[model samples]
Target: MTFPYDRARLDALVADVDARLATVEETARAASRVRMRSPGLGAADLAAISRFANSPDAPRELKDLARRVDAGELSWRDVASGRAADDEGVQRALRTGVPDLRRAYAAIREGEDPEDVVEAGRPRVVGDDEDGPSRFTEDAW
Candidate 1:
Protein backbone atom coordinates (compact mmCIF):
# COMPACT_ATOMS: atom_id res chain seq x y z
CA MET A 1 0.00 0.00 0.00
CA THR A 2 1.30 3.42 -0.88
CA PHE A 3 1.15 5.67 2.14
CA PRO A 4 0.40 9.28 1.49
CA TYR A 5 2.44 11.71 3.57
CA ASP A 6 0.15 14.68 3.25
CA ARG A 7 1.38 16.93 6.04
CA ALA A 8 -1.84 18.87 6.38
CA ARG A 9 -4.04 15.81 6.41
CA LEU A 10 -1.82 14.02 8.88
CA ASP A 11 -1.58 17.11 11.02
CA ALA A 12 -5.34 17.52 11.15
CA LEU A 13 -5.90 13.89 11.95
CA VAL A 14 -3.24 13.91 14.62
CA ALA A 15 -4.51 17.13 16.13
CA ASP A 16 -8.06 15.88 16.37
CA VAL A 17 -7.24 12.38 17.52
CA ASP A 18 -4.63 13.63 19.96
CA ALA A 19 -7.11 15.99 21.57
CA ARG A 20 -9.65 13.23 21.97
CA LEU A 21 -7.08 11.09 23.74
CA ALA A 22 -6.20 13.74 26.28
CA THR A 23 -8.09 13.51 29.60
CA VAL A 24 -6.70 16.49 31.42
CA GLU A 25 -6.14 19.41 29.10
CA GLU A 26 -9.04 20.76 27.10
CA THR A 27 -8.94 20.51 23.31
CA ALA A 28 -8.12 24.11 22.53
CA ARG A 29 -5.40 24.43 25.16
CA ALA A 30 -3.82 21.13 24.23
CA ALA A 31 -3.83 21.81 20.52
CA SER A 32 -2.20 25.17 20.92
CA ARG A 33 0.62 23.75 23.02
CA VAL A 34 1.18 20.66 20.90
CA ARG A 35 1.37 22.74 17.75
CA MET A 36 3.69 25.33 19.22
CA ARG A 37 5.92 22.76 20.87
CA SER A 38 6.22 20.43 17.93
CA PRO A 39 6.98 22.75 15.09
CA GLY A 40 9.13 20.46 12.94
CA LEU A 41 7.83 17.04 13.92
CA GLY A 42 6.00 14.85 11.45
CA ALA A 43 2.55 13.29 11.89
CA ALA A 44 4.15 10.14 13.29
CA ASP A 45 5.65 12.08 16.17
CA LEU A 46 2.28 13.57 17.08
CA ALA A 47 0.72 10.15 16.83
CA ALA A 48 3.37 8.70 19.09
CA ILE A 49 2.98 11.52 21.58
CA SER A 50 -0.76 10.95 21.71
CA ARG A 51 -0.18 7.28 22.41
CA PHE A 52 2.78 7.80 24.72
CA ALA A 53 0.99 10.32 26.85
CA ASN A 54 -1.68 7.77 27.59
CA SER A 55 0.28 4.56 27.94
CA PRO A 56 0.52 2.68 31.19
CA ASP A 57 4.27 2.41 30.74
CA ALA A 58 4.64 5.88 29.34
CA PRO A 59 8.06 7.48 29.39
CA ARG A 60 9.05 9.87 32.14
CA GLU A 61 9.09 12.68 29.63
CA LEU A 62 5.51 11.95 28.63
CA LYS A 63 4.32 11.66 32.21
CA ASP A 64 5.92 14.95 33.10
CA LEU A 65 4.49 16.47 29.99
CA ALA A 66 0.97 15.36 30.91
CA ARG A 67 1.31 16.90 34.34
CA ARG A 68 2.53 20.14 32.90
CA VAL A 69 -0.46 20.24 30.63
CA ASP A 70 -2.83 19.52 33.48
CA ALA A 71 -1.26 22.19 35.65
CA GLY A 72 -1.34 24.75 32.88
CA GLU A 73 2.41 25.04 33.14
CA LEU A 74 2.69 23.94 29.54
CA SER A 75 0.47 23.20 26.56
CA TRP A 76 0.14 19.92 24.74
CA ARG A 77 1.74 21.63 21.77
CA ASP A 78 4.64 22.55 23.98
CA VAL A 79 5.30 18.92 24.72
CA ALA A 80 5.48 17.98 21.07
CA SER A 81 9.18 17.52 20.43
CA GLY A 82 8.87 16.19 16.88
CA ARG A 83 11.22 13.51 18.13
CA ALA A 84 9.96 10.25 16.74
CA ALA A 85 11.63 7.13 18.11
CA ASP A 86 14.32 5.82 15.76
CA ASP A 87 12.55 2.59 14.96
CA GLU A 88 12.20 2.09 11.24
CA GLY A 89 9.78 -0.82 11.52
CA VAL A 90 7.32 1.15 13.59
CA GLN A 91 7.89 4.21 11.49
CA ARG A 92 7.06 2.26 8.36
CA ALA A 93 3.98 0.80 9.97
CA LEU A 94 2.88 4.20 11.19
CA ARG A 95 3.55 5.59 7.75
CA THR A 96 1.45 2.94 6.08
CA GLY A 97 -0.60 1.18 8.72
CA VAL A 98 -3.91 2.54 7.52
CA PRO A 99 -3.80 0.30 4.45
CA ASP A 100 -3.86 -2.76 6.68
CA LEU A 101 -5.76 -1.15 9.49
CA ARG A 102 -8.25 -3.98 9.64
CA ARG A 103 -5.43 -6.47 10.23
CA ALA A 104 -4.01 -4.26 12.93
CA TYR A 105 -4.70 -6.76 15.67
CA ALA A 106 -1.45 -5.77 17.33
CA ALA A 107 -0.04 -2.32 17.54
CA ILE A 108 3.69 -1.93 18.06
CA ARG A 109 4.32 -5.40 16.76
CA GLU A 110 7.64 -7.20 17.08
CA GLY A 111 10.58 -5.43 15.42
CA GLU A 112 8.71 -2.17 15.99
CA ASP A 113 9.99 0.50 18.29
CA PRO A 114 7.67 0.50 21.29
CA GLU A 115 8.06 4.24 21.41
CA ASP A 116 7.46 4.96 17.77
CA VAL A 117 4.32 2.96 17.00
CA VAL A 118 1.04 4.52 18.05
CA GLU A 119 -2.37 3.03 18.77
CA ALA A 120 -4.17 5.18 16.28
CA GLY A 121 -7.88 6.06 16.61
CA ARG A 122 -7.78 5.47 20.31
CA PRO A 123 -9.52 8.01 22.58
CA ARG A 124 -8.57 6.73 26.00
CA VAL A 125 -5.87 8.06 28.31
CA VAL A 126 -4.28 5.40 30.48
CA GLY A 127 -1.82 7.82 32.00
CA ASP A 128 -4.02 10.76 32.73
CA ASP A 129 -5.50 11.41 36.15
CA GLU A 130 -8.69 13.11 35.09
CA ASP A 131 -9.62 13.55 38.74
CA GLY A 132 -6.62 15.75 39.50
CA PRO A 133 -3.01 16.57 38.69
CA SER A 134 -0.64 14.26 40.54
CA ARG A 135 1.52 12.76 37.80
CA PHE A 136 0.08 9.32 38.61
CA THR A 137 -3.42 8.21 39.44
CA GLU A 138 -3.84 7.02 43.01
CA ASP A 139 -7.54 6.34 43.02
CA ALA A 140 -9.18 3.41 41.34
CA TRP A 141 -11.30 4.39 38.39
Candidate 2:
Protein backbone atom coordinates (compact mmCIF):
# COMPACT_ATOMS: atom_id res chain seq x y z
CA MET A 1 0.00 0.00 0.00
CA THR A 2 1.06 3.58 -0.60
CA PHE A 3 2.29 5.74 2.28
CA PRO A 4 -0.15 8.29 3.71
CA TYR A 5 2.20 11.22 3.21
CA ASP A 6 3.45 12.04 -0.24
CA ARG A 7 7.19 12.07 -0.89
CA ALA A 8 7.29 15.82 -1.47
CA ARG A 9 5.49 16.66 1.75
CA LEU A 10 7.59 14.16 3.66
CA ASP A 11 10.73 15.64 2.15
CA ALA A 12 9.67 19.16 2.99
CA LEU A 13 8.73 18.23 6.52
CA VAL A 14 12.05 16.47 7.16
CA ALA A 15 13.94 19.38 5.67
CA ASP A 16 12.43 21.70 8.26
CA VAL A 17 14.02 19.57 10.97
CA ASP A 18 17.28 19.14 9.06
CA ALA A 19 16.81 15.41 8.82
CA ARG A 20 17.76 13.15 5.94
CA LEU A 21 15.58 11.77 3.17
CA ALA A 22 16.02 8.23 4.45
CA THR A 23 14.79 9.32 7.84
CA VAL A 24 11.53 10.68 6.44
CA GLU A 25 10.95 7.55 4.40
CA GLU A 26 11.73 5.44 7.42
CA THR A 27 9.28 7.47 9.47
CA ALA A 28 6.56 7.13 6.85
CA ARG A 29 7.13 3.38 6.73
CA ALA A 30 6.87 3.28 10.49
CA ALA A 31 3.60 5.19 10.31
CA SER A 32 2.35 2.66 7.80
CA ARG A 33 3.45 -0.15 10.09
CA VAL A 34 1.50 1.35 12.96
CA ARG A 35 -1.59 1.82 10.81
CA MET A 36 -1.35 -1.78 9.67
CA ARG A 37 -1.49 -2.95 13.26
CA SER A 38 -4.92 -1.37 13.77
CA PRO A 39 -7.53 -4.14 13.55
CA GLY A 40 -10.04 -2.80 11.06
CA LEU A 41 -7.75 -0.94 8.74
CA GLY A 42 -7.52 -2.54 5.32
CA ALA A 43 -6.46 -0.92 2.09
CA ALA A 44 -9.47 1.38 2.20
CA ASP A 45 -8.76 2.47 5.74
CA LEU A 46 -5.21 3.35 4.76
CA ALA A 47 -6.55 5.27 1.79
CA ALA A 48 -8.77 7.29 4.09
CA ILE A 49 -5.80 8.25 6.27
CA SER A 50 -3.93 9.22 3.16
CA ARG A 51 -6.85 11.33 1.95
CA PHE A 52 -7.23 13.05 5.30
CA ALA A 53 -3.52 13.61 5.72
CA ASN A 54 -3.42 15.14 2.29
CA SER A 55 -6.77 16.92 2.35
CA PRO A 56 -7.37 20.55 3.16
CA ASP A 57 -10.33 19.79 5.44
CA ALA A 58 -8.16 17.94 7.95
CA PRO A 59 -7.37 19.77 11.20
CA ARG A 60 -4.39 22.07 10.97
CA GLU A 61 -2.99 20.99 14.31
CA LEU A 62 -3.10 17.36 13.35
CA LYS A 63 -1.51 18.08 10.03
CA ASP A 64 1.24 20.08 11.66
CA LEU A 65 1.82 17.37 14.25
CA ALA A 66 2.11 14.80 11.50
CA ARG A 67 4.62 17.03 9.76
CA ARG A 68 6.61 17.46 12.93
CA VAL A 69 6.59 13.72 13.40
CA ASP A 70 7.85 13.29 9.87
CA ALA A 71 10.49 15.90 10.55
CA GLY A 72 11.70 14.00 13.60
CA GLU A 73 10.80 16.90 15.89
CA LEU A 74 8.39 14.51 17.61
CA SER A 75 8.71 11.00 18.97
CA TRP A 76 6.34 8.14 18.26
CA ARG A 77 6.78 4.92 20.17
CA ASP A 78 5.95 2.90 17.11
CA VAL A 79 8.82 4.52 15.30
CA ALA A 80 12.34 3.76 16.41
CA SER A 81 14.53 6.78 17.14
CA GLY A 82 16.91 8.24 19.69
CA ARG A 83 14.24 10.71 20.80
CA ALA A 84 12.27 10.26 23.99
CA ALA A 85 9.01 8.37 23.87
CA ASP A 86 5.66 10.13 24.38
CA ASP A 87 6.94 13.56 23.51
CA GLU A 88 4.41 16.41 23.55
CA GLY A 89 3.91 16.27 19.82
CA VAL A 90 3.23 12.53 19.92
CA GLN A 91 0.94 12.87 22.93
CA ARG A 92 -0.96 15.75 21.38
CA ALA A 93 -1.41 13.91 18.13
CA LEU A 94 -2.68 10.80 19.93
CA ARG A 95 -4.99 12.87 22.14
CA THR A 96 -6.30 15.57 19.85
CA GLY A 97 -7.47 14.00 16.59
CA VAL A 98 -5.62 10.79 15.81
CA PRO A 99 -8.13 8.51 17.49
CA ASP A 100 -11.03 10.35 15.89
CA LEU A 101 -9.39 9.92 12.54
CA ARG A 102 -8.87 6.24 13.21
CA ARG A 103 -12.48 5.84 14.30
CA ALA A 104 -13.73 7.82 11.36
CA TYR A 105 -11.81 5.44 9.14
CA ALA A 106 -13.18 2.47 11.11
CA ALA A 107 -9.94 1.22 12.61
CA ILE A 108 -11.03 -1.11 15.36
CA ARG A 109 -8.76 -2.17 18.19
CA GLU A 110 -6.94 -5.48 17.80
CA GLY A 111 -8.76 -8.77 18.48
CA GLU A 112 -12.25 -9.94 17.51
CA ASP A 113 -13.47 -9.05 20.97
CA PRO A 114 -11.65 -6.92 23.51
CA GLU A 115 -11.44 -9.83 25.94
CA ASP A 116 -9.83 -11.99 23.30
CA VAL A 117 -6.70 -9.92 23.75
CA VAL A 118 -6.45 -10.69 27.47
CA GLU A 119 -6.84 -14.40 26.78
CA ALA A 120 -4.55 -14.40 23.78
CA GLY A 121 -1.67 -16.32 25.31
CA ARG A 122 -3.83 -18.88 27.11
CA PRO A 123 -4.59 -22.28 25.66
CA ARG A 124 -8.19 -23.36 25.25
CA VAL A 125 -9.59 -26.87 24.81
CA VAL A 126 -10.95 -27.69 21.41
CA GLY A 127 -14.66 -26.91 20.87
CA ASP A 128 -14.80 -24.93 24.10
CA ASP A 129 -16.92 -21.83 23.83
CA GLU A 130 -15.56 -18.59 25.16
CA ASP A 131 -18.78 -17.63 26.94
CA GLY A 132 -19.65 -21.11 28.19
CA PRO A 133 -18.01 -23.60 30.52
CA SER A 134 -15.63 -26.18 29.05
CA ARG A 135 -16.83 -29.76 28.45
CA PHE A 136 -14.27 -31.12 30.92
CA THR A 137 -15.68 -28.92 33.68
CA GLU A 138 -18.31 -30.29 36.12
CA ASP A 139 -19.66 -29.51 39.57
CA ALA A 140 -16.85 -29.36 42.15
CA TRP A 141 -18.80 -31.66 44.48
Candidate 3:
Protein backbone atom coordinates (compact mmCIF):
# COMPACT_ATOMS: atom_id res chain seq x y z
CA MET A 1 0.00 0.00 0.00
CA THR A 2 1.22 3.50 -0.83
CA PHE A 3 1.36 6.06 1.95
CA PRO A 4 0.39 9.73 1.60
CA TYR A 5 2.98 12.45 1.23
CA ASP A 6 2.78 15.86 2.84
CA ARG A 7 5.47 18.59 3.11
CA ALA A 8 5.88 18.34 6.87
CA ARG A 9 5.52 14.56 6.65
CA LEU A 10 8.11 14.20 3.90
CA ASP A 11 10.57 16.62 5.50
CA ALA A 12 10.32 14.69 8.74
CA LEU A 13 10.62 11.36 6.92
CA VAL A 14 13.69 12.51 5.01
CA ALA A 15 15.26 13.81 8.20
CA ASP A 16 14.61 10.52 10.00
CA VAL A 17 15.96 8.45 7.16
CA ASP A 18 18.96 10.76 6.98
CA ALA A 19 19.59 10.21 10.69
CA ARG A 20 19.28 6.43 10.34
CA LEU A 21 21.64 6.39 7.39
CA ALA A 22 24.08 8.56 9.32
CA THR A 23 23.93 6.13 12.24
CA VAL A 24 24.58 3.17 9.96
CA GLU A 25 27.44 5.01 8.30
CA GLU A 26 28.86 5.80 11.74
CA THR A 27 28.69 2.15 12.73
CA ALA A 28 30.40 1.11 9.53
CA ARG A 29 33.11 3.75 9.94
CA ALA A 30 33.73 2.83 13.58
CA ALA A 31 34.03 -0.83 12.67
CA SER A 32 36.43 0.03 9.90
CA ARG A 33 38.48 2.25 12.23
CA VAL A 34 38.72 -0.43 14.89
CA ARG A 35 39.89 -2.84 12.23
CA MET A 36 42.63 -0.51 11.04
CA ARG A 37 43.69 1.30 14.24
CA SER A 38 42.92 -1.20 17.02
CA PRO A 39 43.10 -4.96 17.74
CA GLY A 40 40.68 -7.99 17.28
CA LEU A 41 38.67 -6.15 14.59
CA GLY A 42 40.58 -7.41 11.62
CA ALA A 43 39.91 -6.25 8.06
CA ALA A 44 37.47 -9.13 7.67
CA ASP A 45 36.00 -8.97 11.19
CA LEU A 46 33.37 -6.38 10.25
CA ALA A 47 29.63 -6.80 10.68
CA ALA A 48 28.06 -10.00 9.50
CA ILE A 49 25.75 -8.27 7.06
CA SER A 50 25.49 -5.11 5.02
CA ARG A 51 23.00 -3.78 2.50
CA PHE A 52 22.07 -0.74 0.44
CA ALA A 53 19.26 1.65 1.31
CA ASN A 54 17.68 4.49 -0.62
CA SER A 55 16.95 8.02 0.58
CA PRO A 56 15.06 11.26 -0.18
CA ASP A 57 17.86 11.88 -2.65
CA ALA A 58 16.24 8.88 -4.32
CA PRO A 59 12.67 9.54 -3.23
CA ARG A 60 10.91 7.03 -5.45
CA GLU A 61 13.03 4.25 -3.94
CA LEU A 62 13.20 5.39 -0.31
CA LYS A 63 9.68 4.40 0.76
CA ASP A 64 10.25 0.85 -0.41
CA LEU A 65 13.67 0.67 1.24
CA ALA A 66 12.27 2.03 4.50
CA ARG A 67 9.52 -0.56 4.49
CA ARG A 68 12.05 -3.35 4.09
CA VAL A 69 14.35 -1.98 6.81
CA ASP A 70 11.43 -1.55 9.18
CA ALA A 71 10.99 -5.31 9.11
CA GLY A 72 13.90 -5.34 11.61
CA GLU A 73 13.82 -4.56 15.36
CA LEU A 74 15.88 -1.38 15.79
CA SER A 75 14.66 0.18 12.58
CA TRP A 76 11.03 -0.78 13.18
CA ARG A 77 10.46 1.83 15.86
CA ASP A 78 12.35 4.45 13.91
CA VAL A 79 9.96 3.84 11.04
CA ALA A 80 6.89 4.16 13.22
CA SER A 81 8.14 7.23 15.07
CA GLY A 82 9.71 8.55 11.89
CA ARG A 83 7.97 11.87 11.43
CA ALA A 84 7.19 13.23 14.90
CA ALA A 85 10.38 12.02 16.52
CA ASP A 86 12.59 13.39 13.78
CA ASP A 87 10.78 16.72 13.70
CA GLU A 88 11.05 17.22 17.45
CA GLY A 89 14.57 15.85 17.70
CA VAL A 90 15.90 18.13 14.98
CA GLN A 91 14.06 21.13 16.39
CA ARG A 92 15.52 20.42 19.81
CA ALA A 93 19.09 20.09 18.56
CA LEU A 94 18.89 23.32 16.55
CA ARG A 95 17.23 25.09 19.45
CA THR A 96 20.05 24.07 21.74
CA GLY A 97 22.78 25.13 19.32
CA VAL A 98 21.56 28.73 19.16
CA PRO A 99 22.56 29.38 22.75
CA ASP A 100 26.08 28.12 22.01
CA LEU A 101 26.40 30.49 19.10
CA ARG A 102 25.07 33.39 21.19
CA ARG A 103 27.51 32.62 23.99
CA ALA A 104 30.40 32.62 21.56
CA TYR A 105 29.27 35.92 20.13
CA ALA A 106 29.01 37.40 23.61
CA ALA A 107 32.55 36.33 24.46
CA ILE A 108 33.85 37.88 21.26
CA ARG A 109 32.20 41.17 22.21
CA GLU A 110 34.35 41.26 25.40
CA GLY A 111 37.76 40.70 23.79
CA GLU A 112 40.78 42.99 24.40
CA ASP A 113 42.72 41.93 21.31
CA PRO A 114 40.43 41.87 18.26
CA GLU A 115 42.30 39.04 16.51
CA ASP A 116 42.51 36.74 19.53
CA VAL A 117 38.92 37.64 20.33
CA VAL A 118 37.46 36.30 17.12
CA GLU A 119 39.82 33.32 17.01
CA ALA A 120 38.96 31.94 20.43
CA GLY A 121 35.47 33.42 20.46
CA ARG A 122 33.35 31.72 17.77
CA PRO A 123 33.44 28.75 15.49
CA ARG A 124 31.64 28.65 12.17
CA VAL A 125 31.09 25.79 9.79
CA VAL A 126 31.32 27.74 6.54
CA GLY A 127 33.63 30.72 6.64
CA ASP A 128 32.58 34.02 5.07
CA ASP A 129 34.59 34.13 1.82
CA GLU A 130 36.88 31.57 0.21
CA ASP A 131 38.89 34.09 -1.83
CA GLY A 132 41.94 33.81 0.42
CA PRO A 133 41.05 30.66 2.30
CA SER A 134 44.23 30.55 4.35
CA ARG A 135 44.01 34.18 5.48
CA PHE A 136 43.11 34.64 9.12
CA THR A 137 39.34 34.30 9.57
CA GLU A 138 39.32 37.04 12.22
CA ASP A 139 39.52 39.58 9.38
CA ALA A 140 36.02 38.54 8.29
CA TRP A 141 34.23 38.71 11.64
Candidate achieving the largest lDDT: 2
lDDT (10s digit) by residue, model 1, range 1-141: 987799899999999987777844676677775532212444665465556556776555556555555676644444333233343332443344334332332343333333333334433445564565435332334
TM-score of 1: 0.24
Candidate 2 residue 127 C-alpha distance from true site, Å = 49
Q: Which stretch of 10 consecutive residues in model 2 shows the poorest summed lDDT? A: 75-84
Best by TM-score: 2
In the range 22-139, model 2's lDDT, one tens digit per residue, is 7888999898866444454345544444455456765665576557656766433332221443566545545665544344334245423323432442344536546555543222
Ranking of all predicted structures according to lDDT, beginning with the best and ending with the worst? 2, 1, 3
Query: Candidate 3's residue-wise lDDT over 1-141, tens digit each?
Result: 987779898899999999999999999988886523222222221121112224333233334434445554234334223343454432443344446435543453443333443356444445566555554434376
Off by over 4 Å in 1: 1-48, 81-141
Q: Estimate each model's TM-score.
A: 0.24, 0.31, 0.22
Candidate 3: list runs displaced more than 4 Å: 1-4, 36-141
| Candidate 2: stretches off by over 4 Å | 1-50, 72-85, 98-107, 110-141
